[model samples]
Target: MNKLFFSAVIGMTLFLGGCMLAPEYDRPEAPVPSELPSGAAYDGSSSSSEVPLVADLKWREFFPDPKLQQVIATALDNNRDLRLAVLNVERARALYGIQRAELFPAVTATGGGSKQRSSADLTESGYPRTTEQYNANLGVASWEIDFFGRIRSLKEQALQEYLATEEARRSAQIALVAEVARVYLTLAADRENLQLAQSTLETQLGSHDLIRLQYDEGVATELDLRRSQTQVDTASRNIAIYTQQVAQDQNALNLLAGSLVPDELLPVDFASVIPPKELSPGLSSETLLNRPDILAAENRLKGSYAYIGAARAAFFPRISLTAAIGTASDELSGLFSSGSDTWSFAPQIGMPIFDSRTWAAYRVSKATREIALAQYEKTIQTAFREVADALAVRGTVDQQIAAQQSIVDSAQTIYDLSNELFTQGVSGYFGVLDAHRTLYAAQQGLTYLQLARRANQVRLYAVLGGGGNLEVAEADFTN
Candidate 1:
């Protein structure tokens, strides 16, 4: 018996040392551009790798408008989508825990009671005899011997999958933050434009009234009165259009907040505040690894690699050891007798010789791992593209903003001069009306330009993965 046991151990060792079935996994390289396009220059702001991701940038620091900041805070706390994201993270954690436990052995207590009766009629001649026997035993059974590393590799794969899920949740959260902030900025800009249109409408109405008075007193021609009225009506119609836009923007903001009429108390008005300061761009590509989605992709790739290792291990011969130790007796009272005690240890091996099924499964796992690697690369490239595009747009926005500001200044000057000429009876009402139209266009452009700058800054943080840890209430969350 001792010699047989030694032979079995040696056989198990030899089989495991032979070879495995799955392929080894290595991280696939990303096929990104060798360098940024010539137009890609980070001139908007400089940043350090330590710059917190957009999510990390507190609402107070980025949006100092007390009212707007309050609104952001409320949305973050109450958004239902955010709540779902938190729950997904918890689920991933629990699933990971379960997978990890599989690496350990399990013990079970087995009990059985049996009774047998034999009848003999002709003993040696296959006769039957009247006899009865009762047997009862209880024992512990277990099986464990991960000689091929299958269980270990499986557990590792699960760990990576769990991490990937967590990253997915974080990525969703990052998008939510950016969306909410973007909507808020949009609302503010639109509100200003709406007010501008309304104010211009009022001024035009006043001018029309003055022109009508002059026409009746024989000081202005009928054409001048007609032109003034046309300008007044056009401006009023435009005001109504902008008013509708402002209302629509507010409604969208309400939806993002996951509420109707979104807490009216949350700050809504900031009196033409300057845009956020330009931030610095980082010095290395490694900075991108900070994005939650990117991290999640990395985790997923790792999990795929582990799965390949496990699948390869599956092709190899697997060995398992089972042990049983318990007591057995003919009577319940003698269940613990010396003769009732017994123990057994057995090892088993299974190897496929010509099984197409195993081969097919292993190949499928390999293909899946390759797919995951490709996807990981794709995600990285997309992230880089987003950052590059945002940076490129930023480089030119400042110059354009400066130039547009000039246009606005010039338009204002032209409108003022045209009004003066009319007051002095030196210009026609057509000139004044045309000048006001130009001014209105310039004003709207300026509002859009300002909003664009803020958006670019926010995008920088989003791509950089700048969020801080959240303190969750563990009492209500189960992992």
Candidate 2:
């Protein structure tokens, strides 16, 4: 009879496991355009079929620069922010495991013997006697039977939270890679600027010496000598500024890389870091759904729905079971004897009758779910804006760079002619000085344009979810 009763309880617990109180989840509509924005600022080229999607391109393939690949690899291995993101993911997974374990009963076993003395006056017999008892048992303790699906809903919520953390870790990795690339490019541009300043200083020094000789021979005015001296001083000051800037850029790059970068791996000039190939944004904007941050937001929204279900389940009865079977006897040797067998079966159910707190909790869960939904929609909108901004820059950066280069060429020609005419005594030193200034400014502008072009490529690649294949590897903390 006891066996039959226990079997019936187990069957009921398993049968009601599917009874969940949470409402079904529906994904919120994306509050953005289905198509990517197109305009004069956006590239209209049909490269969607010609090039691989940015999502499909690995970071190494997108960069293709061996030195940069090594530097990024080192950053991925050592960066502390990325390391913390990975740890958060692991912690969420463990929490999910703990929540999942609540769905099953915890069984235990016990065996013991006890002996006690009884006083004659207390026993109603005029004699003192010893009493003995022995017992053994194996059964489940008080384990909640999830008949209302509260435990299942909680477990689902935990699972979604774990998934969200995993996506967050992936998002962190993508940002880290993009930042490292940008810092690396900035360092290269600064080095190029330093070189430009040094070269300009050398040229100005030569011109100053020539003007001084001419002034001494009464061939050039004192004003020409002073102007030449001023130009030399300007170049010397620029050299000092650029030298400091270059050193600061290196420090920034080292911090991003999480270690000192070797000299050979560092960029030598503004053009030393080649821009990555143009990425295809695909025909539609739906690709943004694959981005890690957006995915993480969606996961959180799902978790919120699960939480609502758990809250609703709290209104229903909570059932639990506790049962034990054992043998008891006055003599230790009779513990397993015939007719010494014992059994027990217990079942309990509880429901909140007048608890206002339960209703408040339920209301809070619904509010939280609404908040999550709003956040998910906002994330998608933000992603759309980012991609659009990147495309706008992409369409115009190359043309801007080309125009600046042409200006630099024109300035170089003017400076050469002015210097020659001044030396032949057909023109004043003023023209040469003015031309030199124009050429130097134009060269600096061209370098800046080039850097902007490269930076735009990295941004577009990142916004498009490039490097999807590069999983953030777990850090080994055992050492």
Candidate 3:
């Protein structure tokens, strides 16, 4: 009889394990264009024909500056936001484990003792009497048998949620790297601007002194001296502004790094900063599908699909089994003696026949899944836009930089000629002041343009989902 019962139990387990009521999942169609937009914005030459995908480049390789790489590594290690993302992935994993455990029985061991006394009038012997009983048992409490796959569906949902959190953590790490690099580049540019301003101020001061001397000798007017001093003052003001900005930029970089950056790791100036070479953005928009944020969105959509499955399973009968096998006797010593053995088997089946809430939940799950689907599509669209914008900037930034450099060169020539002409008494000091101001403005604009060009490369690297080496396991951060 025991063999027959065991065989039946094994057969039931196999049958129920194969049963699933959840609808099959299908990936939604891509909502964006099949090809990336092309025009002047995307006309840049591809990096190298033999080079791998931009995403395959390691962060260290993409950022060749040893100091910049160190800063990025430090930011990844210390950023609070990225740390929180890692912790969330752990939390989701634990939640998934809890849900997955529901498919199995939970057995417990229990023991207890009781003593009772009966009234003399009610006793068969017409005398007061006390009885003692002791019992011990190993039991399984209301473990659900997932015949309709509700437990499986819930487990699937939990699994997808865990995956989504993992992807979110990856996204955070990528953003952190990009942000650190951009801020570091900004600091470099600001330092260069500060130096430029100071140099211009010194030159203007000399010019101011020369004009004052000429005016004293009756060869220059009061206006020429005043205008030269104004140029000096303007340059000094620029120096002050850039100094403040450089300090602020340092503070911002420290905030992202989660600690004060060491001076050794900071760029000395824009000259020391090396911009990354142009990266090929790959041949198609399909690359955006691999982006971490988009992957996270898709996982969320998958989780919603699992939720709908669980809701649909709610309409089916739920079966639970509670069983105990142990011993009961009048005395503690006799609890395990011959003929003291005891066993119980209770199976329950519940179906929601009158409750309207279950149906409502099913509707809610379906609607939620629809919402997730839309959100997934939106994420893809957003990623596509970012890539397109970065490519557009990349295509024109070189030309922009070249043209700006030309303007600076012309302005420098004009300034030199104006200074010589004034010293020769052939032109007024106004020409010298105008040329100097124009040259200064052009130099500042060139500095900003260089920063922009470098920043665009960083953006493209980030939007392309960063390097393959960045795909780290959760254990990497936790340790």
The candidate that wins on TM-score is: 3
TM-score of each: 0.81, 0.92, 0.95
Q: Return the TM-score for candidate 2, rounded to 2 decimals.
A: 0.92
> How well is each residue in 174-259 modelled by candidate 1, as lDDT tens digits?
66667766777777787787788778888988898989988989988999888888887887887788778778877877777677
Window of ten residues with lowest summed lDDT in model 1: 470-479
Model 3, stretches more than 4 Å misplaced? Answer: 1-12, 45-47, 119-122, 469-479
Which 10-residue window in model 2 sums to the lowest lDDT?
Answer: 470-479
Clashing pairs counted in every model: 20, 1, 0
Q: Candidate 3 versus the native: TM-score? A: 0.95
Model 2: per-residue Cα lDDT at residue 464 = 77
Candidate 1 stretches with Cα past 4 Å from truth are 2-30, 33-69, 111-144, 218-230, 259-277, 328-339, 342-346, 467-479
lDDT string for model 2 (1-479, tens) is 97897788779778876787888887767799889888788864335677778877888889877788889999999899999999998899899888988888888989999999999987877799899999999898889988888988898888888888998888888888898898888888888888999999999999999999999999999999999999999999999998898888888878878899999999888666766777888868788988888888988898888899899999888888898998999998999999999988788889779799999999999999989999999889999999899888878888888899899999999999999999999999999999999999999998888888788889888887765544533232101
Instruction: Give the lDDT of residue 427 in candidate 2.
Output: 96
Judging by TM-score, tell me the better candidate of 2 and 3: 3
What is the lDDT of every predicted structure here? Answer: 0.70, 0.86, 0.87
Better of 1 and 2 by lDDT: 2
Best by lDDT: 3
